[model samples]
Target: MPLMRPRMATARLTPSRRPHPVTAAGAKPAAASTMGGTLRALSLLAVLAAAILATGCSTAQIEQLKHSRTGIASGERVVILARQHHSTHEAELDFVECVGNALSRGANGLEIASHSDFVNGLYPWFEPAIAPLNPEELPALLARPGVAERLAETGVRYVVWMDGMTERVDGGGSLSCAAGPGGAGCFGLAWWETDARYEAAVWDLKHVDQAGLISADVTGRSVIPAVIVPLPFISRPQANACRGLAQQLQEFLVVEDQLTR
Candidate 1:
């Protein structure tokens, strides 16, 4: 991959920014407490789910990737922390969805706890740590600083981090032909090629929200490891890739026996 200079990080928080109030006034302490927890949980899931489609798009290759994986255990729950920097809420949501799907398949006992609403975050460390790509290229930045700490405080056990980018390369073709008859002897040949690809990475952290020094793993490829041919130049490839990844992951978890029903 050709390296590009990093672009300045920017914040694009989801339109829905206010955190759901955990407790409502004028209510009994016990009931309020239970309601607060339930509301927060529901809000988180809603936010995460919305983030999945924020990027706004999909493709056939993405479809294949979606259907490839399996289910998680009958009922083990997992948490998703999808923070985005220099990206849209849609992209973030797509990532959350994708990871949720993957877990369902890879771990039979796993279930998807609701995901948190999209948050505006920064990727301050990724700059020099990961070369070439822009800050936007890597989504893990959202987790590096205090974001992880915040999530842990929220009672999240595991975190799935996601980010993506799309690029176009030189696409050209060559051909050969043999001589046959008169002046028009040789046969004419033409080849068409387009070099365009979108990649989405889903990272898993065992206990990130709590640990400052958590080891994050690039769990696996969310989309088809293979690139799409004749890239869709008119559309947003990365968005599509992310969407596919989310759906594929969902499918994988279910099939892999990670998430049942």
Candidate 2:
């Protein structure tokens, strides 16, 4: 009886509470939402970077060009010529014409002689000799007797030599061509990329030295798909090159203020 009086009641133990599975599941969705937002932000940044790159020139060389508030003189005459070589193609001639026309319009009254006029009209006899002159031989050609005199007679103060070509840099996918009662046609899924590269050497005939060198390069890609019907897209790399070269020539020949005026 005495020992039983000292017996004390034992306290009941309770289990600790834990997080609900539903609550854990809810937290997962919130984490996923945050991750989704981060991914979207990253994607947006990539698109913006690509857009900036696409709008501007892929490759440009303008450091050799002179930056002046007062550009070429109004009465000074300029001629655009194509460097002759085995690699020289007809596109260079077109580029020359494009640059000449652009300079004529933007050079603030400077005389821009057409390539044909210089070749066909001024010194037709020397065309064969001068047409083959490379960049290195330009100085020697200018020093030759009657060469400088002829250019002077025509009033050509600056001679710009354009040389380069546009070529398919990369191509992939499959293309197949076939002929039948319908007609000859090509069908496939294909894509190709091209690069247009050219350099302009501006020679100061009056000073007998190179004034500047302007190089421009443009790259473009196109895709063609055919499933019974064919659809082809034009990359127009040469056209892009022409526009870029002409614009650069314009900027080189004219000052910013002159263009606005």
Candidate 3:
């Protein structure tokens, strides 16, 4: 029997175009005005780019993000999908395991599969130079004989698609200066800190089983902050974050049971 996709929700989340940083202070008023104008221009360009990219894609590939899948029906089999852009395969696999572990501990009626055999839909959204796979090419890949049969052998069902990000950590240091009686007693005190933060952004969610594709249900994106610790801190704090976020997502689905499939 063909799996039924979840009903589409009325609420949709449009991507934000807000700039991460505001114009630097200490600039002249005129310069600030110019900067604001530049920011606005960039924002418009971004909107246009998104519109173009979204024009021809299907609902699943475009607006229906389907990131975090929670509140699934009882006994629904589940599979985790992990992808990365410009990051090591090791990193991607680590994230997949983290997700699987979290779900296994908390979620019921779910099963974990091998990370090595997980889905890698080569969709266009992925940055080509770094991680070369396009989602558009997924159907063909799936059709390449024996794919679904193999997945059925594993008893795979739902998919939890994850995207990981790696950014350069900017180490920070602060200096202290004070005034004294005779001469200014200014001392440079450096406090070192790492600005590197890792986070997983859930980009796609789909419920696929041995029966076949289900209707695209939830659509939206979610973020889980990664952990970057100094020497004495835990190496991968992101695991806890992932578990927390997953639990939160599960709660969200429970609340929206009426709205989601």
lDDT of each: 0.34, 0.57, 0.36
lDDT over C-alpha atoms for residue 111 of model 2: 78
Cα TM-score per model = 0.28, 0.59, 0.41
- Residue-pair clashes, model 3: 8
Which stretch of 10 consecutive residues in model 1 shows the poorest summed lDDT?
223-232
**Candidate 3 per-residue C-alpha lDDT over 41-112 given as tens digits, one digit per residue, 9 for 90 to 100:** 454344334433332121121112223333544444455555544446323456556656766665342455
Using TM-score, give the best candidate's number. Answer: 2
| Each candidate's clash count | 50, 0, 8
After superposition, the stretches of candidate 1 with alpha carbons farther than 4 Å from their true spots are: 1-152, 155-158, 170-236, 253-261
Instruction: Order the candidates by TM-score, highest first.
Output: 2, 3, 1
**Residue pairs in candidate 2 whose N, alpha carbon or C atoms collide under 3 angstroms:** none
Model 3: worst 10 consecutive residues (lDDT sum) = 224-233
At residue 138, candidate 3 shows an lDDT of 48
lDDT (tens digit, per residue) of candidate 2 on 1-261: 111111121221111112234633453354345445767445433433332333232332222244222256656788887766544463466667776776677425457876777776546433645453534566777676777677767777777877788788887889798888855645456777778778777777665666566676666665554433334544565775676666766666565343221
